[model samples]
Every structure is written in structure tokens, then in C-alpha cells.
Target: MPTSAAHVPEPGEGDGPEPWPQGISRRATMRISDVLRALRTEFPHVSHSKLRFLEEQGLIETVRTPAGYRQYSPADVERLRYVLVEQRDHYLPLKVIKDRLAALDTGTETEAPVPRLATADGDAGAASARRRYTVEALAAAGGVDRSLVDGLVEAGVLRPTTGGQLDAHALDVVVLAAGLAEHGIEPRHLRTLRTAADRHVSLVQQVVAPWRSQQTASARAHADTLATEIGELCARLHTVFVRQGVDDLTR
Candidate 1:
């Protein structure tokens, strides 16, 4: 089955009623059942036949071992999370999710909307003066070390452009990471945050993906409303989870 949920073992996954398998570390390969348990939270309707159907439908692929048991990688889990989240949240047919995934596989971020969990205070779509930063400028502004910046890239925490320049979002996240570092958390520890953020985007995609269809204007407006509303809901859930953790700790 699937491996672990929350991508990398959240604050207290193991204490749950349906804890994932013991002795199966995050770095270890996992079976299909493992994948299902990991996914059941976000996609409660998931089932064995459904996963097999996805395989049959060619939405997701898995490698088999000597006995032909499915083995999945972290990347595979991330892809499955994307597919399931999209299908459940958007009521998207597998065909559309598969195409969007294929587009992502081809380094097509230009076509993919930047996935943000919270709508910002200002009009994010409104025009503003463009800005770019050299690594040094980014390091100074983000209040991170030059070596830490390179480490962020190595840890898959940052994505530089084709010309190797940092984007505004890059600075924003790095600066946020620096703020977290005040409590001694490292950038490396934040990879799970990025993965969870992608899953949130998958939720928005469910509402927004259909709008791109040559559908009616009314349908497009519905997509816009759902995206913003659902995105806010997801962000609220994240806050609630953090509050729960704090409650558990301080008591």
C-alpha cells in the first residue's frame, strides 16, 4: 500500500488509530496498502479497487518488486497525493488530472499557476513593478547565509530560474524560513511544508481546473469563487492543526 501520510510524518501521526506500518522508515520503499492508509485522510473514499483502477487508467504508475508487489517512492507518493486530491476536491475525472500531471513532468511551471495556500492582502493578480534578485541580494534581504541559500537549493527548498536567478516568492519563503530559524528550525526541516502546500494547491485545482475548459462564463466565475473559498478553508485548517499541537504541548 502507501507509505506514510503528511508526506514526512507530521507531529503525531503514529499515535492515531490507523498508524502506518512500523519499521517502515520514510526512506524505505512501501507497498500499495501503505499508500492507501497514507492517503485516506485527504481522500477518505479511496479503496484498493480504486487505486488499481488508477493504475489501469494510467493516471499513476508504480514499479513492482520480484514478486510483482507495487513499490512506491516519495515522489510517487507525492504524485498519488496530487491525483487523489485533485480527483476528490475538484470532482475532476482522472483524465484531466493525468494531463496536468504530464504537463508538470515536462518542466512546464510557466503553465502551472503558483500554488498558494492563502490569498494575500492585496490583489495578487494586479500589475506591479517586476523585481528580481541576485543571490547576494536575496541572502541579505532574506537574512539567510549564502551557504544556506545554496543548501536550500540542494534540499529542493528553493527553485532558481533557468538563468539561476531568485524570484520574489523565493525571497518571501526564504525570509519566512529565516523567521522560523529564530526558533532554531532549519530549512531542511521545511520540505514537508512545501509538500503539504502542493497538496493544498491540488485542492484548489479541483475547483479551478475546469474553468480552463471552453465553458460558460458562469462556470468560470464559479471556479474563481470556489478556489478562493476552498483555499481559505485549507489555510484555516492548517491554523487549527497548529493550535491543536500547542494545546497538547502546553497542557
Candidate 2:
């Protein structure tokens, strides 16, 4: 029963769905059963309660008919699809997804991955579930040579688990390094970035240390959210600084 920061009026609670961008419509025509049928082929776990919960979280909007039946429009269905895809493929928290959706509505650049429909085989368009990968598998996934991964491991740019498997985080690093490799940057050049990331993580942890130290569930949850927010802000600030530096170089 998580609440959303976005303001979505409950059925019979408010006037109607909020205004959206051009080309978006909220006219209710399909029933909840129709929506379920539309979604369940790809999202097998969707249910009435799950949809209700997402509505409660303000991820989707539903209109009530004169008989008080909940009705969904095509736009609503697409929005639900986006939510489900993000959750299944990216493991994004609802807060982040909701914020992205709101930004989309306002014509803001969300910087989040675009929501894509699942493939015919029900796979999430090769954006599969997060899992660990061996060095060979990681290299294959990144379309890079195994030696590059080995070099990253040697240079402390990638840390494998004690079981010798690299987690999803390592895969991202490998993929980025592979792209940077096209620019002649090597694994050794990534050490500074890794060191800077560690410093940022330490700073975020220090800021949330008090709440994390509390032995209560609420406190721990608050600390986790605070950590994520602070971490994102730090990353954005870093990006701005880098862009500024690049601008100066170009000038």
C-alpha cells in the first residue's frame, strides 16, 4: 500500500484525470477486464489488486462510469504497459518510474529508458532480468573481448563476486567501458572513474548514516530513499561539471 507523491484522484474522490500532453487522451472506454486481458499476455502476474495498487501509487489513472465501474482507456493501458516493462526489465522503484512519467507528461527529458513492448516470445526486448554473469558471458554480452574484462578485473574497474561471477552492476561498467574503448580509452583509464564513484558512495552513506543506524524498519526505509536521492543528485552534479569542462575545452 505504498502512496505516490503524484496527485491522482481516486474514483469518486476528485474531478477527473489530470491534463496530459498533446496526442494523449484519457477517455475511458475499456473495462478493467479488458485491460487485464491486454496486459496478461506479457505481464502474466498482473491482477486486479496489482492494478489497484498501481493506481493507488498514481502510476495509472482509471475513470469511473455512472455505475461506479472502473474503466480504462488506451492511453491508460499504454501507461500500465510502461510501468510493467520498467518494473520487469529495469527494476526501477515506483517513485522513479512515476517521476519519469510525470516528466514525460510535461515534455521534460526524463533520461530514463523508453518503454518498449515485450517481444513475441514474451522477452523484454533483450533487456532481460538482472542476473550474474561469468567473465566470458559478460564479455559476450558487452560485445567485447574477454581480455578487456580480464584487464578491468585486474585494474579494479570491475569486481567479481567470490563465486567468480559479475553482477548486473559490473555488466553496466563493462558495457560503458566497451563504448569508451571505441574512443581509445582503456580499462586502466576507468580507475579514476571508479575511485570517484567510491568517494560519492561514501559521501552518500555518511549523509544517511544516522537513519541507517536506527534499528527500525521505517528509519531504514527512509535512509534507503535518502541515499538514492542524494546519490542521483551527486551523479547529476558530476555530469554537469563534466559538461562544463568539455565546453571549456571546446571553446
Candidate 3:
């Protein structure tokens, strides 16, 4: 039988006890609170419920003690850290992050490995926090007209942030709008793209329906993995189609 990737530790890494508190052992365990404390400085926003929610989402797994309290191993902690960092820094959806990590664990030859950027502290980490952009800033960065930005906001493509500011994600709409302008494709022309995207979302939902229905540990993992694989496959196919079309047009 092929060895499972989850069971394989990274190369040159030992399977010795986690270097947690002096008293803790590989056989020993810690409460969710304790784990939170260990990670709080780096992940200040982390909460007990958030950890449980991540477990529920199938992003990470935890071992249970005899009393049914969660006992996270050092390996599990590392996994959780990786997941959170990816989300905070890259703005990656959980499903994508989960799939990438799983691929790493399994040692699969996938797309170029996700890039890990360096933090200000000289430690390589994900972005520390989300950045919000003002409406003016959004327009400036994307080089789009203010009217177009307003139109997108009205159409629900971009939403106003707290205090009516527009964040970077909201600014992404402006970027899209600017690109469309180059082809005489205004925001209105892109409505079809939005509709198509909605349809694709439904398609993805159907693809993951089986796993979603179960909601078990294994089910979540499978769903995350499947979503990643399908997403990657779709991206690759799209590139191939574009290349083929370009070749045909040139011929």
C-alpha cells in the first residue's frame, strides 16, 4: 500500500517529542487554551472557538484526550500555524490553503510550491493583518475612473467598509474595471463574467456535495483536497484553451 502523506513527517525532521513546555511530552497533552496561549503573540486574534471552527472546517485535526478534551500535538500546532499564516498573508480561501498543505504533506509534484514571504521580524510569515484601502486609494491604484468605482459599488461588485472606506479587496473591482476598459469592455460588460463566476461556484458546490453532506473529519479533508485539485485543473485547462485559441488565430 502507498504510504499516506499525512503520516510522513517533512524530510530531516525527527518524530521526537514536541518542544513545548518542559513538562509536556509527545505522549502528554495541552488544553485548547494552552495552545492558544502558545500561539497568541503571533496570532493575537485567534480564539478558542476559532480553533474549534477550523477543526470543524477540516482545516486541521486534533487528538482527543480520555476526557474528550482536545489535545493538539506539536505537529498539529505547526499545521494550524501554517493554515492561519497562509490565510492572513495571502488572503487565500481555506479550501485552497488546505489543499496546498495536503499536497506538501503527501510530497506530490504539484504547481510551484506556494511562496512564503518574509515578515518584518525577519521571520518568514504570512501578512500580519488585512489591509483596507480607501475609495480614493482604490481608484488611484487601479487607475480607474471614480464613476466606474461607484458603478461597481452600486452593482454589488464592491462593498464599502466600516466608516465607508473601500478596502484592497474592494479595490480589486477597480482593477478589473480598468482591465475591461482596455478592450472597451466596461463594468457592464463584465456582469456576464460575474454571472459565469456564480455558476462556477454552484458547480464547485455540486462537486463537493458528497463531502459537504458528511461533515466528518475525513469528509472535510477530502472536500478540501478535491476543491484544490479541481481548482488547479480548471486553471490549467483555461490556460491551455487560451494558448490553443491564440495559436489558431495566428495560423
Candidate 4:
């Protein structure tokens, strides 16, 4: 005979729907079943092991009953919803989400709205924007050699904008390099800086990818905000480290 759904053991269960082991109460506090049901309603693929994984990630905390059974609260369920929403829509990693949540908990207002870089009517609008700059215009703006601008593009530091021209942001980087060049600095000298930046970006991406799996608008916003905040933090830490190194050398 085929086994039925009811016959199958629910998580933390035996053969039947008997009281939870150790006489745990199903009221007030939520059981694992309630969490699974709620999460499944919103995110159908949520599994018991995934929930356990979330707990391990420190995304949610559970209370244990006297008999050592895990119990989730209503608040815990809501937090899980928030976390899943962020991960699916925004692709935020667990550590970034946790840090953002911690900041919110401490009443820190560090989140910023994401700016849309591209718009509808995409190619034409983008093209028109790029046509505004010529090679001379970009050289003057960024203060770098026209050849350096080309190198930056080749290096993937600046992307081609509309009309096959460098994008405004990419031009800005060249412009900044140009200013530095007047003071005897060169692009080659800053190659390590670019490499460091790329490494930092990869670190942030790895941290946010799991959260990107749970797509929702709010979650996406949260992930973007968290990424920005964490990136800023990493930059600040790098600055501090450099300063500390200099200080030690001077001392």
C-alpha cells in the first residue's frame, strides 16, 4: 500500500500527531511546523534544512523548550520573511543582511535609495548621453592622456557609453586620473587600487548572492542598501588600515 501525507512524519515528529516530546505547548510560541507553513506559503521551496541553515547563518534565532525542542516566535517568522524577500529579490548575502538588520535594530539610518542607472528607451537614451563627450572633451574632463582613457576602457575600468563613447562615470574616473597626473601620479601607479576595488566588489557579491534567491521589491531594496553601506564600511576600514600602517612606520 502507498503511504499517505498524514502517515509521513513531520519534522521533530514520531509516527502520530501526539504532543511534542517533553510536553511542549503549541500555543503562544510557534512550532517548527508553523514556520514551515508560513514560509512555504510565501516561498514554496523553503525546506526544514533550509530553515536550520538560516538559523546557522544567524538570520533568525529560535528558543528551545525545556525538552530541547526549537520554537520560533511570531517575530522570528516575520524576520525570516524579510530575509527571504531580500535574498530572492536583491541577491544580498546573509552577512550583509545581518549587518543591515543589526544597524536597523540599533536605530542607525544608513540605507540609501538605489539610483536607476539606465532607463526605458534604453539604447537611444544611453547613446545620446555618450555622444555628449568626444575624446578631447573626455581628456580635458578627466585630466588624463587620451591614450590613458583608452587604456582605462581596455582595462574594464571604463565601459563604453552611448555612440561608442565612454560613459560619464567612466569619464569621471579618467578626469580624476588626469588631475592626479598633473601632480606626477600615473594610472599605472594606481593599478593595485583597481585590483583592490575589484576584490572588494567580489567579496560583496559573494555575501549577497544567497539572499538574491528570494526575489521581492523590498528585499531587493534592502540588498542594494546593505551592499552600499557595507561597501562604504569596507572603504573606511581600508583607509584606517592605511593610516595605521603609516603611523606605525612614522613611530
Best by TM-score: 2
Q: Once model 4 is optimally superposed onto the true structure by TM-score, how far is the C-alpha of residue 73 displaced, in angstroms?
A: 35
TM per prediction: 0.44, 0.57, 0.53, 0.43
Q: For every candidate structure, what is the RMSD over all alpha carbons to the true structure, in angstroms?
A: 22.0, 8.1, 7.9, 14.2
Candidate 4 has its poorest 10 consecutive residues by lDDT at: 1-10
Off by over 4 Å in 1: 1-129, 215-222
User: In model 3, where is the ten-residue run with the lowest total lDDT?
Assistant: 19-28
What's model 4's TM-score?
Answer: 0.43
Q: Candidate 1: deviation at residue 178, Å?
A: 1.4
**Model 3 lDDT per residue over 1-251, tens place:** 11112333333447653221212123325578777876665666677766776787676666665566777655556667777766555546778777877666555634534433222242322132345666777777677778888777676667686687775466566876777777887666767656755666677778988987884655665565466556655646667887999999999
For model 2, how many clashes? 0
Residue-wise C-alpha lDDT for candidate 2, range 10-95, written one tens digit per residue: 33344533433323444567788888887776776577766876787788767676677788766677788877776665656779
Question: Per-residue alpha-carbon lDDT of model 4 for 1-251, expressed as tens digits?
Answer: 11111222333456543321213322326678877776664465566666766776677667666666677755566567667767755666778778776765444634622222212233442343344566667877766568887766666666565676654566668867777777987667667778888888888877776666656644554455456556766777889999999999999
- Candidate 1 lDDT over 128-224, as tens digits, reads 1135677778898777798777767777788788888877678777877778878988878888888888899898897688774735644554455
Q: List candidate 4 stretches off by more than 4 Å.
A: 1-135, 154-156, 161-163, 249-251
Give residue 202's lDDT in candidate 4 (0 to 100). 88
Q: Measured by TM-score, how close is model 3 to the native structure? A: 0.53
Candidate 3 collision pairs? 89-127, 133-167
Error of model 2, residue 163, in angstroms: 0.6
Ranking by lDDT: 2, 1, 3, 4
Cα displacement (angstroms), candidate 3, residue 17, comes to 12
Scored by lDDT, model 1 comes in at 0.63
Q: Which whole-number lDDT from 0 to 100 does residue 172 have in model 2?
A: 79
